[model samples]
Target: MAKKHKPRVKAPKTASPGEVMEIKTLISHEMESGQRKDRKTGELIPRQIINRFECKYNGETVFSADMHPAISANPYMAFYVKAGESGELEFLWHDDNGDVYSHSQKLEVA
Candidate 1:
């Protein structure tokens, strides 16, 4: 069964134009590395992890990261972005099983 993944973000809803702000994001995932065995059946667990992560602002790429098997479960990321204008921020996570999870938030600038 496929598990549902969810992304959480912490960002200011409003910011001053040209001001720098910190953005934090986290995604829920098991991050199975295929090296672990099931205690019940002693079967090798298939690897499952979010292989990539990206954040975009107004269709423009702002930040991205390449993930690996060594990554820990429930990945957490934090970055900084300069305030520009009112727009939407899009977050995307790519899984090894060809799955993509997305989250979006709106920002307002004065």
Candidate 2:
């Protein structure tokens, strides 16, 4: 599947080891509920939402969520994580159509 938009992330490029850091993420998604009809065709549009989201640091998953239809479009998330040396922060979003979107950020511990 084609990714509609890239995921947004916020984090310091470098931090002291063991320091707590805040992370923010946002992804653009339609979050359809299957109740909406196409404006031009009037055909019922099937539900399409990001079913799941996962955050991993250095290959270890630290946070995850199951998205529901009630979630608004362009989901936003914020969380905290403890820094431990150098690692990669990976974000993943799974859509209802078996499409997976992912983005990664590199972290450096001072």
Candidate 3:
């Protein structure tokens, strides 16, 4: 079976110059622990999770985290960054299935 990818992000459309902005992100994933059994066959489900998450502003990394299966379904993340005149905020998620999901937001500085 092929891996699936999904991503979500929340970012302000604009911010004042030199101001700080908060960003939130989440990815839809099963986060299976490999220990879980299939309901029908009682077979162990292979572990699957979002192993890494990163945020970049104009190509510079601002925040990042190494996630594990213990996190939760649909891993959620929140972080802050300083906003300057106009730039792009990029979010990335790497899944255990070797799939990478990414999303980006562009904003204006007031």
Candidate 4:
């Protein structure tokens, strides 16, 4: 079974309408590159890493990123978005092994 991961997100709870705010995200992952040999068996560790990330605000995509093998473990990203309305901010991380990590935060516009 694939390992479970914890995702972290930082977003403002409230903002002025049309204001740009910063959003931060991070996820814990091993990010094996498949080039390294296992110490015990001397076999290559299968490559497993988060390959893509997406963020949506109120059902509209705000930011997205494509990850590569060169990306370090526990990937972190920060981006900005304009405050629209009181709604949900959804985040998703896609792993090479077909595992997806999800997180959500709510933002209220004043």
- Top lDDT model: 1
lDDT by residue (41-82, candidate 3, tens digit) is 999988988899999889988899999878988889988988
Using TM-score as the measure, the top candidate is: 4
TM values, all candidates: 0.90, 0.87, 0.86, 0.91
Off by over 4 Å in 3: 1-4
Candidate achieving higher TM-score, 2 or 4 = 4
Runs of candidate 2 with Cα error greater than 4 angstroms are 1-3, 39-43
Q: Which 10 consecutive residues of model 4 have the lowest summed lDDT?
A: 1-10
How would you encode candidate 4's per-residue C-alpha lDDT over 9-82 as one tens digit per residue?
A: 99898999999999989888878887899999999898888999999999888899999888888899999999
Candidate achieving higher lDDT, 2 or 4: 4
Tens-digit lDDT string for candidate 2 (41-65): 9999999999899989999998999
Better of 3 and 4 by TM-score: 4
Q: After superposition, how far is residue 42 of candidate 4 from its true place, in Å?
A: 2.0
| Candidate 1 lDDT tens digits, 55-106 | 8988898889999989999999899988898999889999999989999989
Q: Which pairs of residues clash in candidate 1, taking residues 3 or more apart in a chain or in different chains?
A: none
User: How should the candidates be ordered by lDDT, best one leading?
Assistant: 1, 4, 2, 3
